[model samples]
Target: MHQHDRKIRTIGLADVSEPGDEALITPEVSAALATATDIVGYAPYVTRVQPRDGLTLHPSDNRVELQRAGEALRLAAEGRHVVVVSSGDPGVFAMASAVFEALEDAPQWQDLSIRVLPGVTAMLAAAASAGAPLGHDFCAINLSDNLKPWPLIEKRLRLAAEADFAIAMYNPRSASRPDGFARTLEILKEAGCGERIVIFARAVSTPDQRIETVELRDARPDMADMRTLVIVGNSATRRVGRWVYAPRQVR
Candidate 1:
């Protein structure tokens, strides 16, 4: 059915199947699934939408984000109820920005009804699993240097360290660029964050999930992989029982 002809509805979905799955999709997201005539996303994310008789799934490779966004916009302009799925909240280093970026160049698609439904992002889920290291001021950084320059990434890391913000690094180490994360560790250490607490939360909320905390001095580059979300606590962050958190107040 065409989106313009039918009322759009959203429902929350439960993620009881795995530890981290619940945060991945909500009932509102699930409800919207029923109204979708087409779902477009990365292959893995699109696979999570489930296959229904009338729903069309368009899964693409990881690097073609702009192209994917354009395709979604095209489908939507054609009257299909398209749901563009991103792993976490689309706005956070995901498809939301890409979609908008595409829309900006193609003004004709701007009038199409578009809504970005929110979802639990990786940093929040990682922080929750480790108490609240992000209780204070924090920043999330995408470590991939594909689109941006390495110097800019380095500059941001230095500034974030100087500000003492808890840093959450996504896409830490991937097969293509293995040394970037190693360099990240070196920069943090040089910025005098060696004694801070670092948490490596991998595949969080999933069956194979793993969480590890350590002093920055002892943290190694190999501890993280593409699936891992790395969080570096501020100087004030500490360990309490099995959890780690930064106090709401600063000295």
Candidate 2:
């Protein structure tokens, strides 16, 4: 038997918990790292994986998800066990979908074995730190217009507001697109969400973490950056002893 055929080169997608929070690493993810021949991902996430003698880390710039996914697939095809790392759960606004998208475009990669090991997503972590503001009905929306159109985002935001769902926003503001979040806040105000509670959870689970809650009317675009997770509570969301939560009952 060929040496390559003797070992299976399955590609593993590993998710890491927020920075400075080692306790959140799942057992499965920790186990997978022991066998990873190569780890691929954005620089920040890839840096989280400890360097070992046999492991090779390939860190790339942000916004190159497709290229990164393709590189991981190619490495796996070469009989190397590879892990594509993401900050949160791989499936939630992360590398899992990008890898699948790359696979779809390259039918030759369809047979490659791939597994997504889940982790605690950012919103959930943020919600937990804020005392369950998402206890009631809620929806998560990516506010980045890089892939989707702005009108579609606006439409969804308006509809979500109309439905009275708590809105968990990802990629709310970045240096490149500072104005988008400002517009988002304006739209929410127009939707009569001004008095609602808004939480900006920045760098959650990290040493520099900061969680701030304010009324939507008082929220400013400057309060959030790319690293922040912005959560807008529904009509009934309230604060109790420095924590915000949505009461289970209506009326």
Candidate 3:
């Protein structure tokens, strides 16, 4: 019923760890935003986007990934250039999957132009801030129990520990579930990983950023927050000068 005749285009934008890393936004993402007709994301994230004359910003509450994704797709279907913003790499526990899920429910938007622009992820940024704790085999886990059960999270922690994989934990602690991370530490300790090097990288790439290195046994649950990305280094992870990294070889 609308008068527009342009092809629908929905560009999903992945974001950096925090606003302090705005300089790290890829050139491709910046270009896409330049022509974006609408930007949709969590309130704080949408605030990161500079306002313009021809653009509309849709800010929503947290935990509404599917709703937000649908809104973006609907906007695009109306011939508006939509950009759905997410934290870190969208493909990595971000908006990309949610958007696709929405698309699956609405086949009308299937033919619309859809693309995901990558950005700096907190895990990689955290790993880099502490040299290369993930230089060896590694895995990233979201400690939040929003989508998955706590028992499953515990099981993965145990398995990852048994595999001797350097683990990067996302959303390690939150106000609503402060004890989740505390239990995570306990599980890791029970799995005989008490001696592993643990890195608490919070607000990385930001002015308030803090990267702390400590042994797993010494790492406190309070050391992490919702903004923190915790990386548990493997047995080979060690401190070189002031940097902590997993050695390239493990023989």
Candidate 4:
């Protein structure tokens, strides 16, 4: 469709998904973004929904949030190949929508090339490393109270526990959102069996990553955060050396 027979290349963006960690960006992602003349990444709130440093903001919001939105808009208007990096899969709790939402009014982005490549979501990586924690049906919920009300999150946690479904917890704790995950754990412990296996997996596939298995009643509030993944085993979950496995053993 090029009258000059020239290809219009856009920027390739990779999901960063984690704070203070770089392993989330794989070689495949680098190669794609490398092709661009310039690449820009935006990290979402891992623990508490906030922005990071080096990003500017639009005055009315947090500096980090403002900077992230402003940068993408600026690059897009310049007609440069702009790739917005987000943590985890862009589609999951990442920046896919935040980028689009910020630029929705600016139709200039309409013709610009935009692509979102899939990356490792924290939950998936955690579940994999924690054995078969997700081998059966499960649910994932973020425990941040910034956007959603605590009541809603609490309700979901209660429902997940009562249903006896294995659950994955994301954004479980943060400096400001401290009590979200702790409260959820309490609800789960009361609704589910005391012996339920709770796998605390942190920084999966990263240098500081640590994974542990404990009982639902044993999980401490001080032990988790937005960077951690809390896998609450259904009644059948079991622990296997730095990992948790939920089996389908037919009786």
Query: Candidate 1 regions off by >4 Å?
Result: 1-20
Q: Which stretches of candidate 3 lie over 4 Å from their true place?
A: 1-16
lDDT per residue (tens digit) for residues 1-251 in model 2: 34432222222233223454767767888877788888898898778889989999999999999999889888887888888888777888888899888888888767777778878778888898899999999999999999999999999999999999999999999888889999999999999999999999998887878999999999999999978999999999999999999999977
lDDT of 3 by residue, 77-167 (tens): 8888888887776678888888889999999778877878877777888888889998999998988899999999999999999999999
lDDT (tens digit, per residue) of candidate 1 on 15-90 = 2112338545776787788779988887877777779888999999989999998998888777778888777677
Q: Determine the C-alpha RMSD for candidate 1 after optimal superposition of all C-alphas.
A: 3.0
- Which residue pairs show collisions in model 4? 16-86, 16-87, 17-87, 17-88, 56-66, 56-67, 57-66, 57-67
> Lowest summed lDDT over 10 consecutive residues: which window, candidate 3?
3-12
C-alpha lDDT score of every prediction, in listed order: 0.83, 0.85, 0.84, 0.64
What's the lDDT for candidate 1?
0.83
Candidate 2 residue 153 C-alpha distance from true site, Å? 0.9
Q: Model 4: runs farther than 4 Å from truth?
A: 2-27, 42-67, 249-251
Q: Candidate 2 overall Cα lDDT vs. reference?
A: 0.85
Q: Over the full model, what C-alpha lDDT does candidate 3 score relative to the true structure?
A: 0.84
Better of 1 and 2 by lDDT: 2
- Clash pairs for candidate 2: none
